[model samples]
Every structure is written in structure tokens, then in C-alpha cells.
Target: MLINLSKLLSGDQETITEQVTLEMEAFVSSIGTFPVVEKRSFPLKVSKIGADKFLIEGETAVTLDIPCDRCLTPVKVEIPLNISREYDKNTVEEEAEDENLIVGYNLDAEQLIYCEILVNWPMKTLCTEACKGICKKCGANLNHSSCTCDTVELDPRMAKIRDIFNNAK
Candidate 1:
């Protein structure tokens, strides 16, 4: 979706409101591509603040299918996107402080949504707080089932203390 700033720039309307639907199925990030489980509707509002300045604001909710960091299970995570940007047509590329702000007459709605998603995405996603990760020996999901591997629960620093106690005995 491309939003034309001509109306606001030309002083035809003080503000413009539009309900836009983003049909993007996936978003690519450094982690990987996260699939969108639900499409979102954004209520976008653009208001002219000055002769060459505009204020853009919107809110949206989206659900994405991402793998749990521990178990790698597909988890549906809901992300809330709150967008607020000031567009300055007279701003130079070097003078702009925010990279997400629009500088030209045309604004890419999808790209802005993508930027918000990336910004709000969690560093680590877990299906549950008590999720037991996969077993190190057998590669079995500990949350689903138990593993037969004779896993020892030990602290390496206490090994020398154990030896001293054995010698006293």
C-alpha cells in the first residue's frame, strides 16, 4: 500500500484516514522468515502539522508463527504495532534522525509495518515459561516425554569437595 501525501502537501485536507489491510504472509529477519498466521488491519491517520510537515500514526495487531527458542515448536505470537512518525518533506537525508520516518511524497505502508514488526519482535520466544528444552543426549523434547539417557546432575566445582569427603571416610 502506497500512501500519497499529495493531499496533505497541497493543503486539500488537514488529515486523511484510511483502513489498510496488509496481505504480507511472511517477514524476513536476521533470525529467519516468520510466517504470518493472521492478517492485520491498520487504522492509519496522517495529519498535516505544517506546510511541509505531516504526522502519521496508526495501531495494528498481528500474529506470527515463530519457533520456540528452546523446543523449536511453532508458536503463535501476537505482536502489537504502534506507529508514530513525523514526515518532513524539507528534511535532508542526513538531517533525518529517525530512519523509519517518511521523507518523500510516497510512503510504503508495508515497509513501515515490516519495520515495526522487526522492532517489536522479541529476542527470544518461548511456548511456555516452564518449557523443558530438548535433551542434550537423545535429542528428545523434554517437555513432551522423558529420556532414557543416564544424565548426571553435577557441579564441576564440587567434584574436589566430594573427593575430600571420600578421603575422610
Candidate 2:
């Protein structure tokens, strides 16, 4: 998925467009294997903006199955991505001050797509908005059903006495 910009860097004002499709499956340390990401084939429009600059824009829809953080349930999520990158013939240091500057003379499109998806990933994933999670007393999943254990409220005044007896052991 690498794009060669030899013609664009040679002062050519002509635009080059391409259609890309990618399927990626990678392992994630904390979350196990990353779910298969299926991206619909779409066109990537590349146009020369300046003699030494080019604008790359495209959009793609992706389907992913990720595990919920709370209950480890498989959640199906769809992500719509619109990406735009600017390629410059000049070195990146020349435009280091610009925050939106993306210097690419020779770049891999798959790497760029992976990075964009990573950036758009949610900070926390849950199966439902109000997931009750697991119970601390009996290690039961509260989302499935309520536990039968009695809910107790300890008296704060007697906490010191309980601590003294606990220390005696």
C-alpha cells in the first residue's frame, strides 16, 4: 500500500487516484488478538496543491468486532473514516512548526490507515452504557442477575474496635 510520489515531486500538477482495500488482524497485549478489520474498497484522491505540495483525501468505512472491557463480550462497531494528508517535497523540519503538517515523500498507506484507526479508537469500551460489572462479594456478574447476598452497612463507630481485634491476630 505504499504510494510512490516521484512524479508528483517532479513539479507535475497532475493528480493520481487509487482505490484501496485492506484486511488486518493483529495481536494486542491487553485485549488479546485484535478483531478483523474489514474496510470497504474506496478511492483515494490525490491532487497536487503546489509545486512541492500534494493533498491526499479519501473516505472508508470499517467494521470491527472488539471485546467489551467490563464483561469481555464481543461488540460490533463500525467506524467511518475520512483521512487527509499533505505530502511535501521539503523535509519535515522545514514545516515542524505547523501542527497539521504531514510530510510524506514515500509513505505506506497501510501504516497510515492503521494509525488513523488507532487514533479514533475509544478510550474505554463497554458492552452497555450501564453495565453493572462483576460483584466483589461473590464474584458474580451483576449485569446478568442480582446476587442474593445480604447488603450490609458497617458502623463507622465500631470500626476501631474491629481493627483492634484484627491486629491481635
Candidate 3:
């Protein structure tokens, strides 16, 4: 949703409320393939704070199907988003050091909001804290049960150490 800043830029204070859905599949770069992110629909409230300045506030709830790092299993994670931002027509370099910071001027409001969501995504994903990863010996899943192979066969370098222990016994 593109917010028309005509009134706000003209020094007229007004409040604009909007509801829209944004597809964030393309914004996710950290994850190789875009996890299944449901369309985000939320209420956005924008109020003109000053001439060429505005404040944006909104909340969005989204469900994501992410892969676990340990077992590679799909895990459903819900991301509840609440954000507030201020925008000014003057660029950062053009404004004084004490002036309020500005994000986007010519960009659409929805696009800027979507970008914020992408920045808040988590880097690491885990299905559970106790998730037993794949076995190192035979590549079996340790979560289900232990493998029959001897622990010594897993690493050939340990065979000599095992023989020394047997000789000591």
C-alpha cells in the first residue's frame, strides 16, 4: 500500500489507517529457499508529525514453516510483529545531527514495512533443545535409538587406544 504524502508534505496533519497483505518470500535471503511464510495482513496507522515528517505504527502476525538445524525437520514458528518508525523528507546527510532519523522518502510505505520484517528474522532455528542429531558413526538417527556398530569402529584412530586399554586390562 502506497501512502500518499501529499497532505503530510504540505504541512497538514492527518492520520491514515490502512490494511494490506505483503508477500515476504523474496525478502528472506538468509534462508536458502524461502520458508513457507503466510501472507501478512495488518493494520497500519500513519500520522503526520510535522511538515515532511510522519510516524508509522503497525502490527502483523505471520506463521513460518522453517527447517530445524539439527534434524532437518519442519517446525512451525509464529512471528508476531509490532513496529514503529518515523520518516522525514530530508535525507540523513542533509539533516542536522540532532534531527530525527529518516528511513525512506520515495519508497512505498508497504515496501519499507516489509523490509523491516526481513531484518527481524531469526538466524538460527531449532526444533527442540533435546533434539538428538544424526549419529556420527553410521549416519543413523540417534533420536530414535542407538546404532549396533561399536563406538570404536566409528573412528579408526581410536583403535590403537582401544588395544592399549585391552592390554592393560
Task: Give the number of colliding residue pairs in candidate 2.
Answer: 0
What lDDT is obtained when candidate 1 is compared to the true structure? 0.80
Across residues 1-169, which tens digit of lDDT does each residue of candidate 2 receive? 6666656667563777778666466424344666655667788777788766778788986667777777667777776778887756564455233323333555456665665666667677788999876777787778888886546655787878898889998
Candidates in descending TM-score order: 1, 2, 3
Q: Would you estimate the TM-scores of all the predictions?
A: 0.76, 0.66, 0.66
Tell me the spans in candidate 2 whose CA falls farther than 4 Å from its real position: 27-33, 50-52, 89-106, 136-139, 148-169
Per-residue lDDT of 17 in model 2: 74
Stretches of candidate 1 exceeding 4 Å from the true structure: 89-104, 150-169
**Local accuracy of candidate 3 as per-residue lDDT tens digits, 1-169:** 5655554555564877777566455445444554545656777777887666677788876667777777677777676667677766664345343133333332365465545656566677788889887776687766777777655454556778888888999
Q: Which of the two, 1 or 3, has more lDDT?
A: 1
In the predicted model 1, the residue pairs found to clash are: none
**36, model 1: CA deviation in Å?**
0.5
lDDT of each: 0.80, 0.67, 0.63
User: Which candidate, 2 or 3, has the higher TM-score?
Assistant: 2
